[model samples]
Target: MSLVVSSINLKIYFMKTFLAITALVSFQLAAGQKTIELKDFNSLSVGSDTKITMVKSSQNKLVINSSDDDDLSIVNEGGFLKLNGGEDLEITLYYKDGLESISADADAEVWGKDEIKAKELSITASADAKIELVLNVKKLNTTISSDAMVTLTGKAENHNAVVSSDADFKGEDLLTENTNILLSSDGTAAISVKGIVDANVSNDALLKVYGNPKKVNEITSTDGHIKIVR
Candidate 1:
């Protein structure tokens, strides 16, 4: 019985040591992390192998330029910008009063705003890429290029949005006073709204509309299938 008790205590001690090491490593990693800030919005250029974060407080315009290589970008307007994971590069932007735009020659992803008081915003992406916008504001408008995917989520007061992709448009638990969604794809595309969706579509693309249609004021599609779910 004494031998068995000793073995159990030894195992418990080993587990505790492992947990402590893990905790220490985690704290060190977090502490070593750094934040990059872009205050002056002149002409900002980023390589296809770089990642960047930007925040704008004053009325300044920033331009993002990238090559036709693997890249990614995340932007938080007038707030702390955070970005993680990318192959070639990632760039972020924050436009206070001037125009802030992101242009990618390769596959890239961009975000409008982050965890804070929701506001009205707009986002446009280049072709042959994917873009995601998470808004906690009153309204949001988005325009996606060909061979791209645009996703919008959060609550809004009034929203007028357009999405043109060879892929699809997906939404989850989106609430808005007025919403509009438009898709133009060569393949299959769909709109899943939790609150409302009002828009139109074209091409031989497949369009699936779900969620509360009554909450969704209007929707239109051409050469595509439209489905409404309560």
Candidate 2:
């Protein structure tokens, strides 16, 4: 009887110890931040409900700050980085090189930390996506649709934007030599131009232009409105 009781007590103690260790490991993984090394990539595509902060860095790296690091998919495919993130996954990607293009979709929010310097940059966003970026580029191109919103600042030599499907772009702070913008389907934009503006607004869309421009050619239809102010 004494031997059997001692054996049972030992078993219980081991079980309790095992449970405690497992709980501790789970808590550590939940609370700890993970760092991942990355290769240099030119373009990035983000999907799902992830929030990312992109900033310039001396080396390429990714830091997973929230949730499990393994749950987020980060892959470099042919000089392009594709990130498929979950609703709770938050990460910061630091890159050494200038990014050429970015595509954001499906509730992803991307914020740029510092000035993005590139020869040319292209951005496309849709479906509740949001982007805030500052660029110093020769040429910039953007396409926004489906309730997405983009805010742009900094300087570009030339800019072309196509906005539709209730999207919004606030870009009055971007100093540009030339701007060509088209808006349809209740889209709206505010821009600043220094040289020339060719604007076409239709289908209840609205455009507001700022800064002193050398020339302006604007066309509006279907209750569309265009306003240019100093």
Per-model lDDT: 0.52, 0.89
In order, what is each prediction's RMSD in angstroms? 8.2, 8.0
Instruction: Give, for candidate 1, the lowest lDDT window spanning 10 residues.
Output: 40-49
lDDT of 2 at 95: 85
Give the true-structure RMSD of model 1: 8.2
Per-residue CA lDDT of candidate 2, range 1-230, in tens?
A: 99999999999999999999999998887677777888779998888887889879999888887545565778886788888765676688888867899988898889995999999999999998999998899999999999999998999999999999999998999899999999999999999999999999999999999988899999999999998786
TM-score (all chains, Cα) for each model: 0.54, 0.85
**Model 2 residue pairs with clashes:** none
Candidate 2, which segments miss by more than 4 Å at Cα? 1-31
**Candidate 2: minimum summed lDDT over ten consecutive residues — where?**
65-74
User: Which residue pairs in candidate 1 collide?
Assistant: 72-89, 72-90, 73-91, 118-136, 118-137, 119-137, 138-157
